[model samples]
Target: MKIVQSTWVRYHHIDLARELHEMGHLERIFTSLPWWKADKESREQHVPRGLITCNFLMEGVRRMGGKLPFYSKGTDAKLAVIHTKNYSKWIARNLPDCDAYIGISGSGLHAGKVAKSRGAGYIMDRGSSQIRHADRILREEHLKWNLPWNPVHPWLIENEEAEANEASLITVPSHFVKQTFIHQGTAPEKIRVVPYGVSLQEFHPVQTPPDNCFRLVFVGQFSLRKGVPYLLEAFKAFNHPNKELVVVGNVSDEIRPLINSIGTEHVKFVGIVPRAEVKRYLSTAHALVLPSIEEGLALVQAQAMACGCPVIATPNTGSETLFSNEKEGLIVEARNPKALAAAFTRIADDLDLRNEMSMACLERVKMLGGWRRYAEGMVAVAREAKALVLSTQ
Candidate 1:
């Protein structure tokens, strides 16, 4: 089977395609230009260096004066797309000759709808539940941040409804996500649960601490959606003398003042480090804390757990699948600083518990299966879809 994948989500689809191709499938990926290079100068200067590769059709459209469909003539050729709400409609206009297109999440589903009218087999890879789950997180954040409760954001509600109605197959990352979708009016059969995998090579256990402070690292974008405020408040309330919170990510401009006001002497913000450097922080940290109120299956939690560091996350975030409260790692209620503070105290005060949790986390890593497993599962799904198409013909 030949598959073409598209998205602007910064996933290394080339690596995934390579793995699938090695397993006897012809795979081609199509992603948008690097988000950073929206201007003409950046694209011209960087394309030569191969900093980002343009999608076959997008490049042709820019070079030539017309939009042409991708034409590598082969009976087995198939096309898969990552649907984002921003430019999904462009997929149909861009790829007039493709077999199938897929949306990676509900947002993707909204994008895929545009392709559906063009006769593409649409699949929804439910990477995250944008409504039922997002609402839960919104409620939590509202209480913690004292913001207005607007669970049903008008734009998101429209996207969620469109995704449920249009996509033929909806893929979910966890049972929690799958269940949430079902409860939100999606049929159970439409939702397929596929858990995410970790890259063990990039993130593994470390031996020694880098400093005297018991490092508690949180890595990702600094936004309310990630429960950043909750994390800061929890860390502040954690009554540990030797511990420090190392926040590694860019803070949203809106929340900067609020974050700055709460964090004290022991807390330090290291904004947006390189991906390679993230592992170094994870290695040195005693534990990883992700108090995100809204998320699907976060890659950070998986990376941290693979590094043999215990994790403490709220149930609203999909990391709850990996960590059990007082088992593999602590699981706290979303947006509750008091609960998070208590969990932090438990891990910090009890050295034996921390050690035991770390060991369990390693075992959990293997049980959840790694990147290889995730790749194989993807192949199985795609092949099934391919076979169904072939049988009909």
Candidate 2:
């Protein structure tokens, strides 16, 4: 079976394509990432450069636009729509004959339609919750937190919805993402839940945590959607003399003031570290805290687990799919700082439990394997989509 793929960026598609190509299923994959970066990633994965396409000019423009002084969230939203539409059109123009087309949600609506018109299946790969569901909940969260909120642009939402409606199959990384689509009126049968994988080669148990200091690390973008405020409140309330909270990733402008207003004791902000550094942080920390409000499967949870660091996250992050609650990690309700604080206290006070969870994390990664599982699921979904198209014809 031949399949074509497109991704707006690297994300997990490189690994997915690597596995697919090895299985002799990938026709070729298109990406809007710059040529240099894309080539480097493909080389790292042992994927031949001949099996990939890169739209470096458009990617360069998008990158530079984001760095402009006047660029706001509003502009970012507008550019997202423009970029997706142009990229989709470009993909359609260069389309090749294949059994099916698999495209990232917002970036391939036009190409999906073109592929379908040519008697090929179109699969929409969504890595987040439904666009409408995400926008609504994030808006409410911003209002609740009293932060300046720029709502999701309607065109972007409309485009994503159109992609979902037109595709032969919708593929998501987690059941949480699939449920969001169902809640937003999409048929459950149209969606497939394929959890993401972590690179066991890249992340592993490096060393055990040092005694006498309880370290908690929060990775990913530091913003309201990630439940940073709740983490801050919980961290302050944990009340340990030698406790440390390492805040990684970029802090948004709106969250900066609120972070300043809250507890700053023993908190370290090391923004935008390298991938190697991220693994190091996950490996050394006592536990990884991800209080995100909405996401597909957080690969970090697995990465942390692979590093022998148990996770403390909410259900919305698809943590349940990673490890059993209270076995390998803790799960607390979202927007509940008190509960998070309590989880912190529980893990902090128990030494044997910590070691047990760490061991459980390593075993879970052993079972998860890596991106090979995700690639197998995608191939199965691709065949189903092809079958659906041929049966209807």
Candidate 3:
């Protein structure tokens, strides 16, 4: 099968593209970023047949702060909507003849329509919870925190809905994401749940924890959406003398007040480390906590598991798909500081339990089979989507 994939930004689409290339199915990839900007290893290994850069002019505009019009704080979201529309239009106009066209959600509506018209299967790849669900939950969260809520732009919403309606299949990263779409009235058969994978090559258990303190790590943006306030409260409540919280992401301005109010004596905010450095922190930490109230399947959970760090995550993070509660790690209720605290205390108090859980993390990750399996699953989905399109004819 000849497959073409397109995305405005290189999230995991490049990984998917490489997988398809390995399977001898990828015909091309349309991305906003140039090939030189992609990972050096991926570019060397799988030089895709057709790599179309769609953001040359837009990158220049971005460098000139065109997206930031008047130094506005929230203008990027609006600009992102415009960019998605532009990408959709570009793909629609330049779509290649292929057996299947897989495009990221939000930026695929027009392209999907064009692909369907050309008798090719169109697959919508969603990397997070359904947009409607995300908007509602995030808006409620912002309101609870007494902050201004910026729900997703209407243009982006319309585009996502149109893509979902037009695509032959919608692929999501987790069961949580799939349920969100079903809850929002999408047909169960229309969504495919293919959990993401981590690179064991880059993230292996290489470090031994220090004897003095038990360290907990949290990666990703420190924001309300990640349940940062709840994590702070839980960490504050946990009464361990030799414990530390290592935050390995940028602290958003909105959440800084809460961080300051909570005090960061025991917390180290190591803002945004390189991707290769993330595994180092994960390998040394006893546990990784992700108290996100909204997520697809967090790739960090898999990455942590691969590095022998047990995960403490909320159900909303789709961590249950990675490991069972109390098996590889603990699963707590989202937005519940008490539940999060209890889980933390359990791991901190019992050294043997932590060790056992860490071992289980490695075993569970082995079963998941990393990015190779993820690509194979996506290929199967593309094949199925193509078959569905053929049956209709």
Candidate 4:
């Protein structure tokens, strides 16, 4: 039951690696994090240094690009393409003997080919929609809003498509992402839906259900992609005398002017708070709102759920798949401020419904457990892929 995994950064992959190591199934987990940072980050699980393989070259390149005076979106995009190619080649040349290889999408196309030739099932874990689907949708959105838009770099898009084609199995964070791949002509059978889980240690229900002043929370980057402008508009229209909206996370430059235009009367933009503070806001708030136009699975929704905070989000955020609509919270249409405002008012008007939803959120998170369950789900997918590949061989 040996398995190899690759992730360019510590976006939940490190957690998976830690769980696999605990279960004695990790052959190696390749990452772009520097050796020291990797050890420090995964210290909680005590994932041995032996279980990690780092390509500091990738990290160095990223740092160098950031420091360059000419740094811009174009520069970042080029660096991404370069890193993907280099990382994939390095992994392909040094891949170890394992029954399965799971690589985060973009950096595994070449290594996946090598793994497949060795009778190892190649699994590509994509955290978001298919590249083409995402690019098209975002472009359309930006244009509709009359905002400047840059199409995704062709090299990155083509490379991701190649990785998807090369993998024997593909895992996405939510069914919304799965539908994107299916829409792109991929067979539905090859796509697996695996919604992410939050760390229960960092996020847990406080002793009280939401009451008193009506406070609305929105976590995550405040960007056009997240539909922040719409959220601001919704917040403006919602009628409440003692209401306050807490906007956590950094405000993206793209939406700064729109945010200013909306006027933050009762809105508090506490940009980039600590994790504990985020949990505090979630635990105490009446409801959390995520009106994202594009998303994989907005882990904040689940993190808020873990705090027993009812969430009001749109299907595009994969919120529909996590809990029942109007039960756990509300799933409204994206890019619609009226809908968002209506949902906000609905939750605020009924205290009993809010309390019930809060209890439901705690129970739901209990059933989901935490990263352990998500890690186990990935393991199941890997086992299925390994068995299918070995039988064919």
Candidate 5:
């Protein structure tokens, strides 16, 4: 089957494209950022500079001391509406005819519609929880933290719902995400849960834990949605003499003050490092904590596990698919600092348990396989969707 995929940014779609190409099914990939611009190694043929110009303009505005609409809540909502609408229209016009078209959710509406018109199976790939559920969770989080809640743009939700309605199969990364879609009234039969995979070649076990201190790491954007405040509170409450919290991501302005207010003596903010560096941190760390309130399957969990670093994550992160609770690492409840603190203490206090968990994590990753397995699963789903379409016709 000939397959074409489109995404606004160079996400895991590039990996998907490469896999499809290897399987002799990829026709072309449509992306906002060009492969050359994104990575020196990528040689895939893609529609370049689709929404890259808008991204550059937003960056320029930020550099010029203009609070670009991309940053503010209300302003960002407006920008999202404009960006997705333009990107969807572009995909509709530019996407090539193929047996199947795989498009990322928000930006897939127009392209899916166009693909369906051309008698191609349309697959909408949702990388997070249902749009409305995500928005509600974020809004509640902001309210709980007394921060400004900027709900997702209405147009984006509308577009996603439209895509869901039109898609032959809606692909989600995790059962957590599938549940969200089901809760939001999407048919369970229409949703396919294909969890993401880690790059074992890039993120592998390398570092041994130091005898003196236990190191804990958190990777991803520092926001309420990641349950950062809960993590911070738990880290603070845990009474480990040789414990360190290494945060590796961009700190949002709204969360900066809170981060500052909680003393940063033991917490190291290693802002936004490359993937290689991230692997290094993951390898050396004793445990990776992701107390996320909402997410698809967080790829970092698998990456950390691959690096022999057990994860302390909430079920919302779809971590159950990665490792068994208390085997690879503990699965704690989200938004509960006490549970997080207990999990932290459990790992930090017991040397043998920590070491055993690390070993389990390494073995778990091997069972999960890598990106190639993920690609194969996605292709299987696409073929099934295509077959169904053909049968109906």
Candidate 6:
């Protein structure tokens, strides 16, 4: 079961790649690095302004980082899988001979086209559906964050139709995502919901209130799609005297102005940090808030919960499958700063409730099964795809 895993974004790819490696199935990973880090190390030596002006540049940096190592390693694999539609296309020309292909998201089905051309069986990896979930977030944020009309809405609809019809197996992390595909015309038989698992060893809970300040953490891109602005707005109304919002990940230029306006006194931007450092931040936080407009099942949600930090997120975050409002964590309506603020206020005022949620968060991570289960499930899908290819041969 040799596997080539293509990671376009970050955590998801890292999670799957590491899990596969530990399971002895991972053969290679393709991805990129932070642009600023790249520029600092490259022969060019000049600082890249992308970090200061463009989210695409930031992502490009990560893609290039992911790609550089793979480029140097001679290509060899029995099976190649990609996490995104774009990566599938990029790997089509370079992919090694294999029995099957895997696409972790709907867009990734495009990789199946690449595999089909090479006489390989294609399997949909259903990571997240940007078409269905992303749009809802866009609509929610338009009102919540006072965003303008979305120009990308039409394109999202078109892609949803194309992707649903292309995949052989649609893999999802939650029923919410699977339903999104069904709504887009994919049959339920075609969709397989596999929960994205967390690494309990690395993400387990730690001593809270490590510092004097009550840290409310939000990890991920500071974009409307992430429901970042809404989180900021809600945090603004929090009125906590000794609290701080530690925002991790790179900031996009389009939203930087808004992030800055959110008030620097209470908000601290740590910028991009390595995957290893994320757990440390999660450990110190009082709570995790993901006011995302859309997501599959963000690994961060589970990571935070596993770290014993109760999560406060929206229904659309996909991790809501695990959250049992007032139980493991609180669920707020998407795009409502008022609701988000209210949830935070309650947690801020009640120490006992926060402690209970923290304990519940830890318990839920174990009951849901961790990364070991996730790896086994993904391997089964690969085996299925491989079998289908062999049967045809």
For model 4, residues 1-393, the per-residue Cα lDDT tens digits are: 898999987887988888888888899989998888888866766788878889988668778877788778787778778888899999999899998999998878998888878888889999877889989988987887778887889998989988888888999998888998999998999999987878888898664533567998889998888888788889999999888999899988776777788788999888998767778888878888999888888889988999999999999898877888978899999889999999989898888999899989988887876888888888899988887777878
**C-alpha lDDT (0 to 100) for residue 88 of candidate 3:** 81
Question: What TM-score does prediction 4 earn?
Answer: 0.95
Best by lDDT: 2
TM-score, one value per model: 0.77, 0.97, 0.95, 0.95, 0.92, 0.75
Q: lDDT of each structure?
A: 0.64, 0.89, 0.85, 0.86, 0.82, 0.68
Q: What are the runs in model 5 whose C-alpha is more than 4 Å off?
A: 34-36, 39-72
lDDT sort, best first: 2, 4, 3, 5, 6, 1
Error of 4 at 287 (Å): 0.8
Candidate 1 stretches with Cα past 4 Å from truth are 12-15, 35-86, 94-100, 106-121, 132-136, 139-160, 384-393
* Alpha-carbon deviation at 313 in model 5, angstroms: 0.3
For model 4, what is the error of residue 278's alpha carbon versus the real structure, in angstroms, after optimal superposition? 2.5
- Provide the global lDDT of candidate 2 against the true structure: 0.89
Once fitted onto the true fold, the runs of candidate 6 whose alpha carbons sit more than 4 angstroms away are 1-5, 9-11, 21-90, 97-99, 106-111, 114-121, 132-161, 210-213, 260-264, 383-393
**For residue 235, what is the lDDT in candidate 6?**
85
Judged by TM-score, which candidate is best? 2
The alpha-carbon deviation from the true structure for residue 180 of candidate 6, after best TM-score superposition, in angstroms, is 2.2
Which pairs clash inside model 5?
A: none
Number of clashes in every candidate structure?
2, 0, 0, 0, 0, 16
lDDT of 3 by residue, 140-164 (tens): 9988888877778887787798889
Clashing pairs in 4: none
Task: Give a tens-digit lDDT track for model 1, residues 261-348.
Answer: 8765687789999777887887778888888766778778888878778899877668656667787788888878898888888888
Minimum summed lDDT over a 10-residue window in model 1 is located at 73-82
Q: Which should have the higher lDDT, number 5 or number 6?
A: 5
